[model samples]
Structures are given as C-alpha cells and as structure tokens.
Target: MAVYQALKTAGVDAVTIDTANGFRSKLKRDPVDLVFLALHGIGGEDGTIQKILNRFKIPYVGSGPQASSLAFDKVKAKQIFHRNGIPTPRYAVITTKNWKRILKNWQTPYVIKPVQEGSSIGIFFVEKKQNPAKKVEAALKKYDRLLVEEKIDGREFTVGILGSEALPVIELRPKRKFYDYQAKYTKGMTEYLVPAPIPEKLTKSLQIMALKAHRALGLRDLSRVDFRTDARNHPFVLEVNSIPGFTETSLLPKAAAEIGLDFSGLCLKLLSMAQNGSKEK
Candidate 1:
C-alpha cells in the first residue's frame, strides 16, 4: 500500500492489478501507457509478468525478463556471480542421490534454502550438532531442488543499485538468530543502519561489488544486492533482489532518502526511468 500512496503522492495516474487473481487477460486489455511492477515472488519476479508486458509492448520499470529470470534463480545467480569473479558463499546444488551424503559430510551452521523461492521461504539454518533430517525432509516434500551453502557468519548488509550507480550500504541486525521470513516482515524484528558503520574503504568495496554483481546478471534500472561480511572484513554476495519491496521498512527508499529523495520523488524517478527505457544492454 506504500507504493499506492507514493504514486498518489507523486500525482501519477496509476491502477493496481493483482496477477495472482488470474487477471492476466484483464491486464492485457488495460489501456495504460506504462507499468510499474510492484508484484513479487514466483509468478511476478520470475519473469512471467515481464514476458506478459513484453508481449503487450508495455514499457515497465526495472530489469527485463531475461535478467529477472537469471537473478530470481538462486543457483543461476550464484553461478553468474562466481563466473564473474564476484565473491559469494560456497554452495552446492542438491538432488536425491547426493542429498543424503551432503548432510552426512556437511559442517554445522550451514544454510539451507529453496533454489527458486524468495522472501526467504523454506530457508533454514542447521546449527552445530543439530539434526537437519526433519527440516530437510519437510522442505524436500514441497521443493524438488534445494541449495546447501556454507553460511557466512558475520554482519549482514545490503546495497541498492539505481541505474549504473550504487547507493549507500545498509547494515542489517536481526534480533533473531538469523534473518528469516518473520524477521523480514515482522515490525521491530530487525534494525537497520544506513551508510553502515564500517570503514569507508570497506563500504566502497561492498558498493563496487554490489554494482558488479548487478551488471553481471544483466539487471537494469534498480536492484538490491545482499551480503555477509566476516570478521576478517571479507564480504560475500548473498543474492540480488530484482523487484525489491517498497514498504515502510524497505531498503531502497531508505538509501534514496539519504540524498533527500523522498518516497513520492523516488516513485516519480522510477516512472521516469521506465519512460526513458533503462533496458539491459
């Protein structure tokens, strides 16, 4: 609803349509000149909506279908990041055959996540001496594929990319053991520090890496790159959010506000970027 208020505050003639309600056919008939994609998760962030917009020749904000597809898949995004010399946590793609062996030899405190889900859905952490069979079994019942990653134990941070520039780094401190679904959505569950209280050099390094990760995936317009920095000050890229949230606690708006850009102004700026076509090269 924040996006709605921002659009109204910006004086943009906008309408909301939920693709989840089987409104694809109805949306194609709408005579709107531009589209601001605020939808997220499976059908929306995974390129399905972007393809529909392309078929209708509708100009939209943020990355194109290809970029969206590449970034939405955690395994594919990690591969792209590694190939491009970007530092990301070590991970293994699991299947039925190797899943058992992986758990047997796996180190404690590892990270487990679904290969393609977002908003940290079906993500869990296995601490030292913890039996992961129950959690793994439950997740496998719902998802055929999963990613087992060596958790980067350190401070968490996120970088916002707009156009070709990287915004200020925002440090995240979750009150829980880790930032899970509840920590992300529940109010006061986490704390954010803008322009993270790290050394200036490290801040610049993270921003540069965030931009590199963004471009490597061919993402255009705006994106948010997450990270985990260790005690040694080494930062590992976690993942990229193609269509990040614009809620009251959203990071993009927080970074934009550092430069005096209000929520309504950011909404207008995104519309301008859409009209100008910040399509991936």
Candidate 2:
C-alpha cells in the first residue's frame, strides 16, 4: 500500500506482482520501467527473486543478489562482520554432527536460530544448563547449518537508512520474551518508540554503525539495520534487512516518519534512487 500510494503520488504508475508465476507473467506482458520490491522473507529477501530480476535485466529496489544472499544468512553475515572488524554478537555455527561439541563450549543464555530464515522464524533462547542440546539438534536437523550466539542483554533498536543517510532510530519493545515472529507482525504485541530513548552520542553511533553494516554488505537504496546495545551501552549488529517490512506500522516507515518522510515520500525516494541507478548503467 505504501509503495502503491507513493508511486501514485509521484505520478508514476505502479503494478504489484506476487509469486514466481505472476512475476514471470508480468515480465512477459509488459516492459517494466522499475520494480519496487516490497516482498519480505524467503523468496523475496533471500536473493531468489533478486537473482531472477537480475537475469531478466530488471531494475529493482533494494540490494542486489549477492548482498541479499549474504545478508540473509546470519552465520555468514556475522563472519563477514567479524572479518571486517564490525562488532556483532559472538556466535557458533552448529551442524547436526557437531551439535554436542558446539553446545559444550557455548556460554549461558544463547540464542539458537536457523542460518537463513528471517523474521525471527526459528529463533529461540536456550539457558546455560538446560539440556536443550537435543532440542537444538532436532531444530537444526531440518537445515544443514544453524547459528548459536551469545545473547546480548540490552535494548533492541533498529536504524533505517535511505541511500547513504541514516534515518532516525526506532526502538522495539517486544511483549514476548524476545522479538519473535508473533511480536513482530501481530498487533498490540510490540511497542515502537521513535527516536529511541538513548543518549545522542549513542544514537548517532548506532546510526553510523548501521550505515557501515549496510554499506559493508553493498546494500543499495534502502535497508534496515537491527542492533542490541549491551549492558555497557555498546551496540552490536544483529543483522541487516535489505528489503524491510513496509506495512503502515512497520519500523522503517515509522523511522522515516520521524525524520519527516512520510510513507509515500519514502517509497518515492526509493523508486527515484533505483531509477537513477539504472540510468547510470
């Protein structure tokens, strides 16, 4: 709805597509000027659709295939951040065979999550002494790899970036134990605080870190960077969402609003960015 309204307001006709079949049909029927990718999770944000768009020579919003792929895999993302000296939570990659070995060395209160899934789909917190190793093994049995990270205790904040500029920070207060899928999409489950109640310096630092992470992964147009500030107020990057949620109540939209950019304006700006990029190439 935001993208449709934005394009209409900007005097540009917009067409929405869903599923692989629909996308293929649209490509066959019309020569599209640009694609405002608003799809989230799995096929949308996990680089599958981006790969197809690239093959079709379609100019789309958000990051390219490589960036999208790297950003979606939390384990690989943390590794990239570590190699680049970007601060992220300490994590261990768990495989089915070596689950016990990894669990033996894991610190207390760690988060176990699927490597590639997003929207907090398969994330769970495991306590120190709980023999959830079996649970972790069973959970990871479906996937070849898993990510177990030392849970950082602190406030959850997200920074939205428009091009290279970082918009205002939005704090997420999850009603659940953590910001799970339910807390994310369900109404009245999470509270979003604009201009997150943090010191100016810390907020600015988080914005800078978020922009760095986005650029590090080569994200284009817009992206949302999630972080958790430790007890000492040091921020740690969780992951980057190249194609963030765009619902009226989404965090990126809220942050954009805080910085004086309405939903339509934000979408239009993103479209313009993609259009300008295509012209350059």
lDDT of 2: 0.86
Winning model by TM-score = 1
Each candidate: what lDDT? 0.88, 0.86
What's the count of clashing pairs in each model shown? Answer: 0, 0
The residue-level lDDT of candidate 2 at 207 comes to 92
Model 2 misplacement above 4 A: 279-281
> What TM-score would each prediction reach against the true structure?
0.96, 0.95
Q: How close to the true structure is residue 60 of candidate 1, measured as C-alpha lDDT?
A: 90
**Local error of candidate 2 at residue 220 (angstroms):** 0.9
How well is each residue in 178-246 modelled by candidate 2, as lDDT tens digits?
999899989999998898888999899999999889988878888999999889998999999989999
For model 1, the local distance difference test gives 0.88
What lDDT tens digits, residue by residue, belong to model 1 across residues 202-249? 999999999999999998889999999888989999999999988756
**Which residue pairs in candidate 1 have backbone atoms (N, alpha carbon, C) closer than 3 angstroms, thus clashing?**
none
